[model samples]
Target: MNFANTGQMEITTLENFYRDTASLIPEGINKEIGHFNVFKIEDVLARQNKKVMPYNRRAYYKISVISGKNKAEYADKVIDIEHNALLFATPKIPYNYVPQDDDQHGFFCIFTDEFLIQSKSGVVLDDLPLFQPGGYPIFQLSAEEVDDITFIFRKMYKELSSDYAYKYDLIRNYILELIHYGQKLQPATTLYPSHTASARVSSLFIELLERQFPIESPQQKLNLRTAKDYADRLAVHVNHLNKVLKENTGKTTTDIITGRIVQEAKILLKQTDWNISEIAYSLGFEQVAHFSNFFRKQTSFAPLAFRS
Candidate 1:
């Protein structure tokens, strides 16, 4: 019920996901070639100790065909799915999947970007409209479309458990098939209005901001640190970006950017053993003192104090 903690959402790794759901990893999975797995939605739900899915970014890509009533909460929006739908989720955004009824039946497949690299599918996952930030990635499905999707998922499940040597290659083709299928249908974009240029710019700014996050290492520094930097990347004036964001989100550009940085700082402080300097540098602060000041001003707690 509390969405406030959503700001401090952590990235869910595959190991933790499997352990949390009590789902067994298939024996023949090769992590080096990139991990890929498919599961029946009911089977996964039945094995879980709790039915709740947290609001967090996954470290892998996921495509799900969900049939039933459900609610999906993203950082800036909430979508109520009343029927069968295909959902595509990328690692860049955080979302919470909440089922509203007990009659849920579907399938979901999670795979790393590496999983598709070997296939040379020529389709960059990020370039796809479905996985783009602020793009409508969920599609409402008709009964026939649902049957087509279900058939693909079932084939994936079947091939995954088989003894065939070229099964992964075949599986990759099926994944591409689903991707193409979803592309052919219209995205449920009407659910989120982007009717104006300002709205579109605001969406792009937010996407650019989100793409820099989940900093995997202390060595990975934040790229676009300021509103001006984002404006340049977006080919818009800084004033224009700020005004658009203010009109759309009721927050200035700096407010949104700093708020996100503070959120990531909090996550790093609590989740990792990284020192203050490492965390500060990663968040684009040149000095630990500056980061400390920013943290105290924003969250009213020093980084170390919050960690303790």
Candidate 2:
């Protein structure tokens, strides 16, 4: 989400999202494994708290129950939720919601891909149609459906407070059940418009970039790390690609690519025990020294030093 092409759209991380949405520090036992969180709007308001969500792509999946009149603006479509409804959001899309009236009511929860991976399914959350590109991610709820959805949220909140060892496993199943419930409502209809030339190139460039990610193992090396590689795949001159990116995101192609790699490097260093060389090569650096130098330049810390 930190690419050059993202102009006014900001990226909201889980920690900051919690602070903004609920005015909480996200402390306690789950701080280290802080990939999941839940909040009720009523609870937040009763505490006289304020919500501060801007238009952006949240770095996680958000499922919520909303009531009254509210509007959600996505990349391709604008949806108005009336009465009770369920809404789904993914990282691939940038969106924001504005309350049309003072009667907003809801429960919301956010979880990262890693949160779901810990479950038995062993699947990537982004690969699911519910969160995939050009897929439907919203549903309206009847009063009965609202009751059912609220019940699911109640189970999640209750399990999250329990001492059960397998609570997350049960929570994951409930999340899946909610997802399947939405999927069964009707097939996902593509709402995104066809891209313009510059927009198309940028979109293709992003898709090509994300394709190299998650770096499943040390044996997996990133294929597209430079501006030239992306330009070639997009069938455009490298200069043209760079110009479009700069125009769209206020950053050159190389800057955007490096930012993404460095961000990934930090994530791997923080989340996994991968050795320096493994992390280095997986990110497409030829030598550990080069990766070390790059990481230091970008983050002001040596690789192992950062890990420590």
Q: Which model scores highest in lDDT?
A: 1
Instruction: Put down candidate 1 lDDT per residue, 4-28, tens digits, no spaces.
Output: 2212336678877887788877767
- What's the count of clashing pairs in each model shown? 0, 1
Cα displacement (Å) at residue 150, model 2: 1.1
Task: Put down candidate 2 lDDT per residue, 199-232, tens digits, no spaces.
Answer: 7787677668877765656788899888998999
Query: Among all windows of ten consecutive residues in candidate 1, which has the lowest summed lDDT?
Result: 1-10
* TM-score on alpha carbons, each prediction: 0.69, 0.57
TM value for model 2: 0.57
Give the CA lDDT, 0 to 100, for residue 295 in model 1.
95
lDDT of each: 0.83, 0.73
Q: List the residue pairs that clash in candidate 2.
A: 4-249
Q: Highest TM-score: which candidate?
A: 1
